[model samples]
Target chain A: MAPRKQQEIFDATLRLVAEKGYDGLTVEGVAECSGVNKTTIYRWWPSKAALLGAALIEADVLGFDPPDTGSLRGDLVSLVEAVTRLLTERPSGDIAVAALAAAVRHPELDAHRFFADRFAREREIFERAVRRGELKESADPMLIVDMLAGAVWMRAVFRGLRVTDDFADAAVAALLDGI
Target chain B: MAPRKQQEIFDATLRLVAEKGYDGLTVEGVAECSGVNKTTIYRWWPSKAALLGAALIEADVLGFDPPDTGSLRGDLVSLVEAVTRLLTERPSGDIAVAALAAAVRHPELDAHRFFADRFAREREIFERAVRRGELKESADPMLIVDMLAGAVWMRAVFRGLRVTDDFADAAVAALLDGI
Candidate 1:
């Protein structure tokens, strides 16, 4: 019930998922790792998907402060870098991939909701650009975000390729200035 | 072992994966559906992931002719449309999502190989564009492909959004002329 206790559970869940993957993760493992009762976890989260989703959200694992970098390119590069880290970094990347995999089989996982929430949060960068006359009023914010993030996902997750240091800058430039 | 029989097995595997998610798919189900011996399927494919991968390859479910349209923009739109169909269409889309989900748990699935092979096959389009002076020699072909395909995957799979008819042209235009 306490915030500290919830953080412990969330951390334990992410750690277990990173170590054993989604298929191997269990409420019992979270319980054991976090020193919380399995009944308590279930009472709070209801199911493995629910538990994982809550942990991902409550732990702020995928959270980032949307940059207000003045220029659209600068803001986009920051956003891309943030996404690159989430898809390439340790526990977060592993947990995110595991969640994506699990979502395929379990629609109740509501991975789309996670992405939707993120897009909604990031929409402000584009709005700012449009207001400043930096971007067209008709620019599709969601599509732009999807293309940028999707490129990272394609390389890091799908291709098993490294997200190089220059990728964020290069991607933003290519998308913004055209190849 | 014959080509015809092998086709039957591959079709059955894809169908089973489409009907049941990768987690639900089994060699026995494939064998039953294909009217093939379970041992034969096992002897050839060895594992479920291998079987699924081979089925995807042998079925040519993801295959498309590289458009030789006179212009690079036209070719890219064609490629985007092809990718959209693969990600949004039935049986192929279902099988693809299932394979991708399975790949996350089973590294042996080698989904990267599938993408690699596709990229290799499509590389000629860029090569031709360069030869025709349609594209800059400094252009990153793989990044271009990844960004375009990534956008499709983001909309179709990640967001569960319908990739509209105009998306291909719009995306190509955005990437080519800058947003």
Candidate 2:
């Protein structure tokens, strides 16, 4: 029951967003879909943004934290593969894209906590690489992280560009080579 | 007169898409708004997707093709600065964000030919550098470009991330250091 309540909310939230998109998502709709009361939903989260953010946090999103493999290439493949898989899989990319678009207009609610935290986590991963000296001291780890993260997302989500395994290998090779 | 006619159509197309989104954009709406006949619009392009794609291309905003400044650092700066300008100065990012979203549904027409081609062009610029020994021979140009473009669009468009020089600088620094 403990897990059920939380899972219900997150599952319901994902489906609603996927089906209706961010604009059509509503607390009322979530409650109706999940069979949870609106008051119960609000008690847990201040608003729909909070609820949605919480859902993303709660969901296993293929692990945003990049793993520390001894080599930079190993670590990158781990990072890129996970992100690539996420984007390639159903609903994750779509949900992410929709959430981002919605956040633009409702920045006060969506921007402050969840979004900043996500960026910080991304930076934290890169900073670790810098500390380990797996990368150049002058290299901007955030830039590297962005390059990896950005390419996959832009291809899959935005431009609908495709990334093959050969492409991924090339990407890993290029970043290591260039930086 | 020649430039103005095309400009009017592009302007009207943006307004229409922004107001009604890509799905709602009509040849009729664009024609009426621009005071150009529907026949004229159709005679120029084959479909609504064609019209929209032309508008994006007409805006000339696939971001700048990076100029060779000898130094990758300077080249990177130039590239980032160019994108930063495009992101801030016009509704370029917004239109792009919209196009990507639209592309998800209308894959062939919008994403592959228009946006993806421009994205590919940027990758080619970097890849050639690799070939010239300016960058690492093994450097994955396509992947790096994906990251560079994705990170910018993700932060600015999705997160309501501001297009500050500092942001671009940080991104450039991070990318150079990390990758």
Candidate 3:
């Protein structure tokens, strides 16, 4: 397959997965949507999970380049806000839930690595915060990241609540100052 | 169908969903596993999503009754600990992820209500805490609940980290004392 064709196939995978969810997605559907041959897709990606994972990375479905806004609070809020936007503004949440379910059912898929890599970049804000003395040096960066992101996910995804700007501000405040 | 038959079918549905995930599970498979006919299952549950919801409730997949441990801290730890046990000790996490993905794919199934009811019981601890004057009267009980549960889920479910008793205590402290 040509480089351009491979990219087209990945783009098609993202569109199909986002629209149909992972289970409803098929190699044939990708072939149809991308105008690429099924044999070629199979030759490049052995399974639907593989195809989806590559598509996620290549398309930057959950990617974020956290901006350094000088203040830890500012940077953390932006990082979390980006997550909220991905989960709420786009079809990324559906794709994530689909991948999560698929990852649980098929352990070989290793979706955790994909998310962990993406989330690690967001964690850099905390490290910068500590250096700037915004947060206690002893604070655990991973825990802080987990708590902030987890709360957003719980409300927005699991509980089906809107991730409003007010909610984002409250989350950041609660994380910074004890509730 | 007899009451005993209904229980058996639900049990079978849980077993199949936990084992196979929702996408791979079929009404025919449940009937074969339970030794009940597919027609009977359809009569009881209009769809696979409905059947899985009922099975989840009957199986107590995310069920919890937290004991009021006098302090908000104590109760919160216990509630999170129970969530940890459910997600880690059993195949309940797989069931939850399965349902989450299914709910996303089929909006009419209303898995949110199913989880809302189960999670509402866990929220009672926070209510008790507010009543005891352990937490501020103005605190948003729902947000508190979301943060606590979300942190545990991020680590235990998303990060695939061990939700140790120590980790549970730390999570409660962080929520109470701010990060």
Candidate 4:
């Protein structure tokens, strides 16, 4: 499929998910919304889970390139801000929440794989921090990432709280400097 | 209604949510499973969300008493362990996931109320820590609690990771001592 065609499908998938959630999303709906034939969509992605997963990955919805800010604090703040945007922004935020809710009911969706892939990509920031001697080599990268992201999830996703402008900076400072 | 009868209804609600997720849960199924009349259930609860919310609250599914462990680290470790058990244990864990998923689709469920109540109760631990001079008075209690509980949610609920015995201690240490 052409890149533009794939983008259209991905956009439709995200839009549908944002509007009606994952359970309401269907390949037929995607085809109708995207103007793509069902046959072609099935030929490329076998299942609804596959289609949604591909849309998320191809759209770079959950993954972000680790920023090289030359300092651990700067890099972490950037990463946290990226997560804040992902969870607080439209389409992406709604799609992420829908995906997470769907994952609870359908383990076959393999939400863990998406998180794992994103975590792997994001680990580079921590690795560089350790190499730069800014972080201890023994620091658990997964824990750090999880705490930061999970705090955002709690505030922005779980409680539906308005994330303030200082949230990213404050979160990074708390994690790095201790509360 | 008798205490035993209320317990049965709550139990049925939780069990159904565990087996079939929240969307699959219904008052009729709960009534049938619990041997309680649907009319009687509705008279008291009024709606499915109300019934589920009552069950969660009356059963203390999400709320835990703040541990008075004499020190900040001890209290935080205890709090983390409580959250770990809530997310990792049967019935409660499954019910929590189902309710959270349902909350995303149905904002009327007021999942935030449950979390808010839980957080409000848990804040006492931090208050006590400040009184004991173990934590700074300027510490953001919500952020501290959110980070600790959020980390456990990330490990146990999100990633479905096996929480080791040392997880609570390690998480608390990381938060208090900085990563």
lDDT of each: 0.87, 0.67, 0.75, 0.86
Q: Give the per-residue lDDT of model 4 (tens digit) for A71-130.
A: 999988998888889988987788888888988888877778777878888889988899
Each model's TM-score, in the order given?
0.93, 0.80, 0.87, 0.96
Mind giving the per-residue lDDT tens digits that candidate 1 earns over B37-68? Answer: 99999999999989988887668655667888
What ranking emerges by DockQ with the best candidate at the front?
4, 1, 3, 2
Q: What is the lDDT for B143 in model 4? A: 87
Query: After superposition on all CA atoms, what RMSD does each candidate show versus the true structure?
Result: 1.9, 3.8, 3.0, 1.5
lDDT of 3 by residue, A65-162 (tens): 87699997777787678778877775677667666656665666667776677667767777787778787877777777777778788877777878
DockQ of each: 0.75, 0.43, 0.57, 0.77
Model 3 ranges with Cα > 4 A deviation: A1-7, A24-32, A35-47, B1-7, B26-44
Q: What DockQ would you assign to candidate 4?
A: 0.77
Error of 4 at A26 (Å): 1.5
What is the total number of backbone clashes in candidate 3? 0
Candidate 1 scores a chain A TM-score of 0.93
Better of 1 and 2 by lDDT: 1
**Model 1 Cα RMSD, Å?**
1.9
Fnat per model, in the order shown: 0.71, 0.50, 0.58, 0.64
The lDDT leader among the candidates is 1
Query: Tens digit of lDDT per residue, candidate 2, span A29-117?
Result: 98998898999888888788888877776665423664677666777777778778777777776666666555544454464355456
**What order do candidates take by lDDT, descending?**
1, 4, 3, 2
TM-score winner:
4
Best by DockQ: 4
